[model samples]
Target: MPHPILETTDLTVRFGGHVAVDHITCNFNAGELTAIVGPNGAGKTTYFNLISGQIPVSEGRVKLNGTDITRMSVAQRTHRGIGRAFQLTNLFPNLSVLENIRLVVQSKAGRGFNILSMADSHAELTGPAYEILERIRMTDQADQVVSELSHGDQRKLEVALLIALDPLVYMFDEPTAGMSVDEAPVVLDLIAELKTRKDRAILLVEHKMDVIRTLADRIIVLHNGALAADGDPAEVMASDVVQEAYMGRDLEEALANV
Candidate 1:
């Protein structure tokens, strides 16, 4: 088995008196897909923030390929090979899809503040960024302005931008949020394909159970800032505490049918 790409040991995050994420520990292995699911306010996003360096950890540590990075800044983490996509669709509305990916590649190349310079000066980064777009099957839409693309295509472009960073572990916070059923699978498929790469691991914080069931090798359930269940999809799905706290009756019924 390959070494885990990301590991959290007693990771905790506090806000004032509220503990948004308790001492939770989990591992994300390379070439594997892990899903983190929970009810609203269960601190799933908070946990992502800690791992991605969007916020500081009050206790515990986040390790990427065995190096502790609990105190790293977001930019530092990104450079250390941690890429991310948000729950909200994040893209420059005025820029074309190709331009958006180019920007990400340039940023990851440590040239984010060179508006006056030629973007082609970093052809190495831009070339790989274009390749990422092709991987997500968005090359045809590369020249289209972000605002003009469909919601599904925009989500694909968003992931493409992250792919351009070539991170070891990618954190996606509800990549399908606010999309119709028809639109959500487009983003989910993008994630699934990314997981197939042996060098990349995915930490997915998502709500769609059907989508989760299809993609997750392991599932981590969070409730009230603590881990409620952590195991294979079948085991986590059968957990009564998870069923009640977040899975709800629909998931229970779906589990029964399965």
Candidate 2:
């Protein structure tokens, strides 16, 4: 309803003859946590790739804050206040938790003029890194090398690192991937905390229905590369079309149970 932070119009992506994403349009509002959910091969990830400029659009436009950025490079998008994390955690395994975050903060500080200067000595960057870790409740592990951290701790650290970028919109592709059931909660908690902040928009591509229901202010369901359902979680989850597409016979039964 309000001015959208990110939006797509007739967004489509194709690889050769196969259409991975059809002409679909959606908007992610600022300060909202929106989940894009669908069965496997539903073009969820492809849509993310399209919006983040990881791949060129076959046809369509992606607008960030009313500016056309469909053709922008990944770096351009990041500098324009878009940040993304993969299903697999991306981090420098050998670096200490604080160092990894400090690197991102420093890079974003626009001080390439001092590239070779002692990064650790840059209190401006390190100060924010610790503040970010503390926000995610990972401050205690700030000095630990990433390689020694548990799978759950690493996931939290990855989120901590992303927060240091201070992007207006963040795209998280399966942030809970590769974690044990117990570990998944750590990632979920971090995401939950992020949703409370009103400074940015967050889009998540996730299969975990429970997590989706918990975090999404809105939910978009994709089916075979097209927009299937878009609305509140209860409405979308109750739709017969979405049920049949994703839950099949079990879905109808699930609705009845509900």
Best by TM-score: 2
* CA lDDT for candidate 2: 0.83
lDDT of each: 0.82, 0.83
Give the Å shift of residue 96 in candidate 2: 2.1
Q: Compose the digit string of candidate 1's lDDT tens values, residues 1-258.
A: 679889999999889999999999888899988898777788988898889988889999999989998888998899888988877788899998888998887887787777787776777877887788777778898888999998877777776767777799988887876667876766677788888787799888877767787999998888899998888899888778777765465454543343
Overall local distance difference test of candidate 1: 0.82
- Using all chains and alpha carbons, the TM-scores for the candidates as numbered come to 0.87, 0.89
- Alpha-carbon runs more than 4 Å astray in model 2: 180-186, 250-258
Q: Model 1 off-target regions past 4 Å?
A: 111-117, 180-183, 247-258
Residue 196 shift from truth in candidate 2, angstroms = 3.0
Q: Model 2, range 1-258, lDDT digits (tens) per residue?
A: 778999899999989999999999888888899888777788988898898888899998999999999989998898898888776777999989988888888779876579577877888988988888877777888899999999877877776667788788988888876677876786688778777887689998877667776888888889899999899878887888787766674432442343
